[model samples]
Target: MSWEQIIFYLFAALAVIFAFLTVTRRNAVHAALCLIFCFFFIAGTFVVLNAELLAAVQVLVYAGGVVGLMLYVIMLVRGEDASQVKQALGQKIIAAFISVLLVIQIGSIVYLSFAGKATGRLAQEMARYGNTESIGTLLYTKYIFPFEVASVLLLAAMVGAIVLAKNKLER
Candidate 1:
């Protein structure tokens, strides 16, 4: 394989490993640290894919902003409250099923792309308008609603995290 492909695979593997570690860790701080590493690896993959803007955003937004905020929330949580929660058996089974489905979906997507079933339309657009411009155009035009919704959802999540932390502090 080419150097780029090798680097991409390496980044992808590390990202997956860190993500799995993030989910499986019992300690919230350790999980958050794993998540940060996962985000960094994902950013590396984006860089290998020639999407530098996405790589930067992944680092800045996820690794820097979101995970930092998560760490604060985790710290604000009382040790007893955090330690008392445990994953149910049903939750584990459901998570495993979802993981299997995601693996199958990803495998199918990779197969289709390798088989040349994936459309070249996106590549054509990227070539013509350039990566950042095309992404901006699509995000502001076609996918504006979803983009706005996502922002609002993120805001809600931040608010919820703060509220939960405050509640824990009060107790």
Candidate 2:
């Protein structure tokens, strides 16, 4: 296999492993660290896919901004004790069933996508519009309203977080 393939698989494996650790780790801080590693590996995968803008955005938005905020919030909360809530046997069974269903669904989708025949015209059209410039142009021109809505949603989330963390009034 090529070096690119090797690197891609390495990053993919690391991303999956770190994602699993993020979910299963007992310590909250350790889980957060695992999530950071997962994000980093995902960014590496994006880089491998030749999507430089996406890779940078993944690192900046998810790894730097979101994870940094989460770490700060964790520290501010000062939650020393591990999670006390334990999953019941029924809940575990349900979770496992749901997970298996999701895995099957995703596998089917991926298999279908790769197994389908591709038209040369459609491939050419996609190539013309798949670049960062084309995507940015479409986002600004056609999807500007949705982009602004996302900004508003993020702003609302920030406000809600601040409000929730603030102390209660002395009334």
The parts of candidate 2 lying over 4 Å away from their true place are 84-90, 116-132
Off by over 4 Å in 1: 79-81, 84-87, 105-171
Model 2 lDDT per residue over 34-143, tens place: 99999999999776666767888989999899888888878888742457567467976898799999999999998888877532343345566665777699889999
Error of 2 at 14 (Å): 0.7
TM-scores of all models? 0.68, 0.78
lDDT of 1 by residue, 31-69 (tens): 999999999999998877768779988899999998998
- What CA RMSD would you report for each candidate? 4.7, 3.7
Worst 10 contiguous positions by lDDT, candidate 1: 116-125
Please report the candidate that would top TM-score against the real structure.
Answer: 2
Question: Model 2: which ten-residue window has the lowest total lDDT?
Answer: 117-126
Instruction: Score each candidate by Cα lDDT.
Output: 0.84, 0.82
Q: Which residue pairs collide, candidate 1? A: none
